[model samples]
Target: MEPKNQTSVSEFLLLGLTDDPAQQPLVFSLFLTMYLVTVLGNLFIVLAVSSDSHLHTPMYFFLCNLSLNDICLSTCTVPKMLVNIQTQDQSITYTGCISQVFSVLVFAYLENYLLAVMGYDRYVAICHPLKYTVIMKPHFCILLALVSLLLSTVVALMHSLMLLRLSFCTHLEIPHFFCELAQVLELACSDTLLDNVLVYVAMFILGGVPLSGIIFSYVHIVFSVLRMTSSKGIYKAFSTCGSHLSVVSLFYGTGMGVYISSAVTDSPRTTAVASVMYSVVPPMLNPFIYSLRNRDMKGAVRRLITAITSFL
Candidate 1:
């Protein structure tokens, strides 16, 4: 091995979401708008959860954590992406590259686990209504959230640390918009067995664990719902879970689409476009989804709007 090869790579090229000069400004403006929406929308969720005493429950606590994670996740990638587009430079310093990848991994995985925990929360509330509070105590909810954070951090650390060690002596061009782990791994000059293993491990931890938990919770929920004697009761019970189910579907569906698209397609531009749905669409839409569908959220929004108008 050459000394030059052994030395760490200090920078990387992002390649961005596209190569078309015409599309650069369009993508830049679009993401700038979406990034602002993601931040403001999640901030609203956090505020709604915090200000509304009626919402200070285990479920809302998890939701608050979720909104926080969504904010972090979007902030991790979007600003740099916008910069790449506007500056006409697709370069990222090695430190910045690693930081973005780690932050995305951390918060993305947090959403997965938080959503799963929310499913379980709904299960307890609906299936075992008698003991919902006993089971979903404040301490338990906080602990679950903290565990999600810890788990995500550990998995991200594993991948980032391993990727950091492998010097990228050449092939600085990253395939996708951001410093995605897969794209970064593609840029490595050394053998990537370690990187590959770390990525696979991260996917398993992030995807498999939460998915399994959600499945089990839904199974129990279905059983409970089926046993209901009244149609209205069933409808009402299912309604309680409607918002959560919507988020889960959108989040996982778009996420899986990105993964499958990357696997089946070779075009970096295509992958970046597909990845946008997962990264940008859900958080941007969540506030609307919940606000339109949830009465409490609607009321909170009304109050917030009224307060602002009065101030004006």
Candidate 2:
């Protein structure tokens, strides 16, 4: 019932992204709007993909998975943060904090792996067109999705279990908007030499590995595109990757930017602002990146828009 090693800190006070009480109202409104956009955007992608038979293919199937993950990831952090802001209650229960940490990691890594998988799907569709339908059958698509979900869930469980074993010291304020791994590790009362190693090692394994997969898939895709006999053919090959390319860039770029910005700025508020690009903006934009840019998705959206308006 109680943590043995440290004084029982019932609720951790999140020293939020800023100590400037003046900015709390502004930040609350901004994040509240972003949260609504993230939810509505990702949810619409799932609904549109599911409702439209024309959109039921390997690409959209993986897309729907990404949209769902984005929604989950955003939900894990943003709403609680907004409530904490408006109520001026920067408190989170021990159980609630841990649950958010675990859920956020699960969906964050899920998006990473899912993006890589979707990249591979595009590789098949564009470079190996003749075999696209056969290779990316309905059962096969479901299997890929299930595997990504499995991996994300498994990793989240492992990391959370490791955290449970560790004890925290008196310092409980997380520097960033959400409980980032590095920030939490800094609060650990017990010897965290192993935990730090594990955390960075995970940063490399989960983050580095999927990132490599995305890069490698694109390399082969580029090579295949170049060998094409005609300009039109090359254009067609590049077009297949347009949506995925944007999503991958948005996710990794903003995430890496957060680290790089923190290295330079050394400011908690700056890091939190950069983190918003990764945690909030990407999810809000992913559906549009896919739907607005991809011709097929554009058509599907048009139909869904028409159908919804018809009922209204």
Candidate 3:
């Protein structure tokens, strides 16, 4: 009596956020609105960055990539959930679930790395303003982005490939809206010691390293700003870092909250709700944080809107 291979399990049922029949339409509408807002908001950020010549700096370069990553990350899970809700069908094929898992990991890690890279960019700007241009050349910025993408892809592929080794049981209902890697792993009938070990290792390398880098960058930035004697210089320094700090706080704060909540609670539904705070809310809020807090970004977005309307 051996467990079935992953291929043999044709599909898994996603229980989504709620099971109440009366709430289906409301759920569908809410997620659809969020998904649309996420896509359009991030898309506008990308377009503004690319269209404005004033935004051709290393910081904007990284911001553009981040906007793209956020769009991909939201697309990875939300659309499938929306489809399931609209169709009243919660089944996701084996291939689709695995693909979702891989895609989610890739974009999530990319976002993490980009945030760290942006932090370093800020540190260099604030700590060594004279060498900012030389330190962050266009080619160097491109290299950092490519390296982040490569590492994110490699790490995600490793996890997804390792998941292929596990054998699953007949009970294939996932209590989450999407095929979260941890939820999927919990359903496996085979011993998941190796899988769990790899997960922990990846968490440390991918998650902890970037977080540490961000903290390190900010430490120097804070010290550099403190050395400035003029009140205007202090205000200018904080203003430059304000949008980035707000975004970083939203991303990591929600993520850490989700992690802690999941660890404390055994309820899958509770965990799923917490996951939305990190996954859905941050992406939706990032564009607003940047555009509203950043004068340059606001001007660029306004110009972009004007150009589009004039052409129409």
Candidate 4:
């Protein structure tokens, strides 16, 4: 049932990451820099992967998709936050908030699944090297990407549709920079038992399943590496997955940290502050992690830079 007393509410006030007037400019500048770095870094990864023929394999193909996901994920939240901070307007219209939620959900879930797919790609490349080409063929890679996008779309749509059914009350101040699903749900006026249940189920299916897959893939990869006769082969195999493993640790760790922080703390502001670690940090760092650790990526980036400079 809709709340009759608060039926006229049209906008939700986002409290944002901070409320200190003195800190606003600093925050804006800091986030703007992070956002730019995140965008340019991921863009470079995408461009490098696309331009370099040597990176046309399944691993780099998935890396390109992951970079694309990182771009969208950061874009969905950072731009809005930056706009709000720069304008000093925390009010987000209902439609805008819903759109933000949907976009963020889609990209976030897609990234999660894409990381798992990358793990599986590595698994195939390492465990069954002979069949890697057959298993991760171009068509198959496309199919995996399609499946990730489709699943994420469906899940985001489900959350968005469910959100549409709920009526918000007069108290619509969200204590976060963006319309995160959990924060938005907390502001709902109606009974959210079903929404809560759905979120849990979806989290288990989306988050748990993918994390399990990544772990399983890594476990097999480790076993395979252990079986290698040459020490150099083990080192090479580990080096190849090092960047991915770091990302997975950072991504899942920050997410779990946010969840745990929210659960253990009673402060919405604290949770919001912690959320930045997951939302902003991972995307900003992923490019550096991949590029710095990878010789092939370094060469591709150099080539990309050289070509761009020559063209200019």
Candidate order (TM-score): 3, 4, 1, 2
TM-score of each: 0.95, 0.94, 0.97, 0.97
- Model 1: how far residue 307 lies from native, Å: 2.0
lDDT for 246 in candidate 2 is 90
Question: Candidate 4 has which clashing residue pairs, if any?
Answer: none
lDDT tens string, model 3, 1-312? 655555477888999999998998898899889989989999999999999999989999999999999999999999999889888899999989999999999999999999999999999999999999999999999999999999999999999998888788988999999999999999998888888998999999788999999999999999998899999989888888999999999999998999999999999999998999988989999999999999899999999999999999
Ranking by lDDT: 3, 4, 1, 2
- CA lDDT for candidate 3: 0.92
Query: How many residue pairs clash per model?
Result: 0, 0, 0, 0
Q: What residue runs in model 3 are displaced by over 4 Å at the alpha carbon?
A: 1-7
Off by over 4 Å in 1: 1-6
The lDDT of each candidate is 0.84, 0.84, 0.92, 0.91
Which candidate, 1 or 4, would have the higher TM-score against the true structure?
4
On lDDT, the stronger of 3 and 4 is: 3
Encode model 2's per-residue lDDT on 206-293: one tens digit a residue.
8799889889889989999878889988877777787899989999999899889989997776787788889889999998888878
Which structure is stronger by TM-score: 2 or 3? 3
Candidate 4 residues lying further than 4 Å off, grouped into runs, are 1-5
Candidate 4 Cα deviation (angstroms), residue 52: 0.8
Candidate 4 per-residue lDDT, tens place, 198-308, comes to 899999988799999999999999999989999888888988999999999999999999999999999999999999999899999999999998889999999999999
Give the lowest summed-lDDT range of ten residues in model 2. Answer: 1-10
